[model samples]
Target: MTTRPARRTRRTGPALQAAGIGAAALLALTACSSSGDSPSAPGASSGDSSAKLGGTVTVFAAASLTESFTALGKEFEREHPGTKVTFNFGGSDTLAASITGGAPADVFAAASPTTMDVVTGRNETATAPTTFVRNRLEIATLPGNPGKVASLKDLTAPDLKVVLCDETVPCGSAARKALDASHLKLTPVSYEQDVKSALTKVELKEADAAVVYQTDVKAAGDKVEGVEFPEAAGAVNDYPIALLKDAPNTAAAKAFIALVRSPAGQKVLTAAGFLEPAS
Candidate 1:
């Protein structure tokens, strides 16, 4: 039997060259086929994988976020031309309930961690919620503060008609904490479903004052005036944002959350009277 040429032997012959070229071609074909059949990476850190993003990103956010989030949403759409941002703004507890009850949302931005827990507790979020901003309670009185409400305790005067967010809402919860911190008890004329409604009562002149976030008072402009109190420092709420586990448009939604946490997004929020997130 004839011995085969040594495997490592150099050969300048056309026959050897042809054989080497054929092997390389076979390997190239194998690599191409494997790469084509393999699965894609689960996600990119930028929330924009190699795939193009286009679709509506549905966000369930706190009622207090109406102004700032709306502004940020518009900016998001501008940055991602083909993408759309839709929001369901409401009381944090109500939003959390809707999410747990199977609402199709790509993101959730709660006014408080307790409300956020209502979703993260059930593993509805892709990751732990992140605190994007902090908010403090402020007394929202009619324009010029006709009620003369100067402190959280002032809302307690028997003659004043005050409105408070329902105890379940984040603003209400913070108000409660603030009241506890000050060791005072208050009874509002009515307990509204959300902070905006509570503030609306004051704006519409239905009530003398309402305990709401400073941002809401600022957003109201001439409709209302904000009164800051020392107790507010004790009850500042941390606003949290997260990507939903069942997000319909993951890439776009993730990108939206990223924008909300970005410096530009913080500018819009801070301009609306929201405080920066605690370090």
Candidate 2:
């Protein structure tokens, strides 16, 4: 009876045991949070995740971007691993029409800003465009001065077999502007759908001379001699690029756009004879 308050025994019942277990779980969760491995990590995983880059991205680019873009695409695949870039290269206008008609494309690169405006006007562009390159007109002629076509005015000579870009294409439109500025009239033997075709005619010696982008002549190398005309200054075309509004692979498209604006991509484009856009 004098044991007024026997020393209390430590709790060791099922309820106490359950309470301890609950405390342990709470501590473990706190540790996980402090260790930077909480549910937030999974939320972050869904953003900018490396797992989202394996899909294929289709790009519709101006025919002039064919060589440089192809090289960039190869490099992108090599660096990205599992990403594929499929390009549909043609006149910028044609590419815009294709995209507007619901063709699947993740990106668009045009040789001229005007053509890019066409696609952008339709709200087909996902982002603001960036000018990546500038190309000036050049007079391509057969090797060894066969036609002696040196100036824009000389192209007006009726005897010369001149090839020009169709008015609908960037190069053709630029050629017209340059000619109009110089007050020269050129009656081309054929109006090509794109610059490549116009340059091809001169490369094959099918035409005595052709007005094409300077990069085109450089790409052709010895196939055709490039003659820089003074009037070319009047017709410099700007190349622009942007992601498509309805891109099936938005991440990949943005990556491609970034690459094109990167130093590595610029080097490739420059090597192919394209000029870096003026600062």
Candidate 3:
């Protein structure tokens, strides 16, 4: 008598069926999205694989790195076909300034740590920089050494038309440190903005002598004669290189940096009179 017949449940029609189908479709889309990779994420294979790299990487380097980096750039291009490398070489300080001022550069190879600091301080570097090479100063005399320049003290001679890098440049700062370490005060005929400029003056015979980097003198070859001074040891310049934070070609940029720190890169720099970075 308490079992009044159990009521039969009503079955849902097309509306309920449609809602069930919609929910299933939504879940399928979610699963597909979750399984795929995001476009912005870095691919593990892209880093070391040359096939994944194919774009222009612009490098801004110090004048001192001109010869060495140029060689490295060519090698990089050879290793990764379909990649183009464009270089802008100048004073490290100037390059740092340009990069900080919205210049488009994929990589920066500075002549000194202080110059690299300029870019790092501005949050321009993607990662902590690594020192690749070091350099020391030398007096670059005309081909014939007509000034008879031999030491830092010889640069102080009134008869000699000595040129130095402007204090704003890395080479100039290193030159200043060198002169100070020697307790030598020199009044140069002019202060060129970069080591290359100062070296160029002596190469062109515009100045009787110039205080430039040993690398520069070596790169200049027969155009100038290098005179190593004892004080240069105290003013060694540590070159730091980094990939820019906003690099347009990050894959290629990283590869280029790897090449620069490679053994081949070191050989080129060492051949150009640059010292190897301490391990």
Candidate 4:
């Protein structure tokens, strides 16, 4: 046998800057970025039909999809025996940058088109991304609505402690939209990296309230209360999903995406509080 040397690698393009997500979670991509292989899924033709749905499918998705996607991942594994499904859920912008930075994921699901463009703009998608679900913002308050935050303006109170998503991510973008629509200016005590983090601030009683996705409030159960405002309608975010151009498990990726768009998938998502994709 011949002896071989381990390859030395360097960090590439703000790869470690997505602090909203665990640095250790993205450590798998700690190597030089490849220009990416051909933008084709070899065994699969086009769309989510796929060739054979075996192997592990690595999906980089927005944090909001945590619950629903987890259930779907389990369903997928059950539907296709011997197949494993793994996920890296985080802020959309962070996930997008990871994909473009050559993280070697099979699919990318973003909370908004703007975030999805970060990957698509770099030509990292095997095909056009499809909008799979939508979400609207809501005020997550203490379990009993102790803050009496009846409207978006209520969050502006100086005595109240509020948390929000950082402007770089999709949830933050939608929150900004809603605020702008209502002509409200709010300075959250801290800006979180993802919707789940923002909601957690309220659930943990660390903050009086936080602006996050309605789905998050529902997922939180009785730990927090949801307050819907009309302005949220203007800020609904459309989630998009696509196969990565250099996916290592294209067949599994396509099959997983197909399952997400299937009727059964929509049922699970809807039950988790996600809205249907706009036709």
Model 1 per-residue lDDT tens digits across residues 59-126? 99999988777767766665567888999999999999999999899999999999999999999999
Clashes of each: 0, 0, 0, 0
Candidate 2 structure quality by residue, lDDT tens digits, 95-200 = 8899999998999999899999999999999888889899988888887757776577778888889999999999999999999987778788999998899988
For model 4 the local lDDT of residue 103 reads 92
Q: Candidate 3: lDDT of 207?
A: 94
Q: Please, what are the lDDT tens digits per residue for candidate 3 over residues 1-279?
A: 122222112233435433323343233323433454232213311136535688899999999887677766766676678998999999888889999999999999998888899999999999789898999888888876777666788889988899999998989998888888777898998998788889888878899989888877766656777777777788888999899999999889987887676554555567667998876
Residue 179's lDDT within candidate 3 is 82
TM-score between candidate 4 and the true structure:
0.82
Of the candidates numbered 2 and 4, which has the greater lDDT value? 4
- Report RMSD (Å) for each prediction in the order shown: 23.8, 26.6, 27.4, 15.9
User: Who is ahead in TM-score, 1 or 2?
Assistant: 1
Report lDDT (Cα) of residue 201, candidate 4: 86
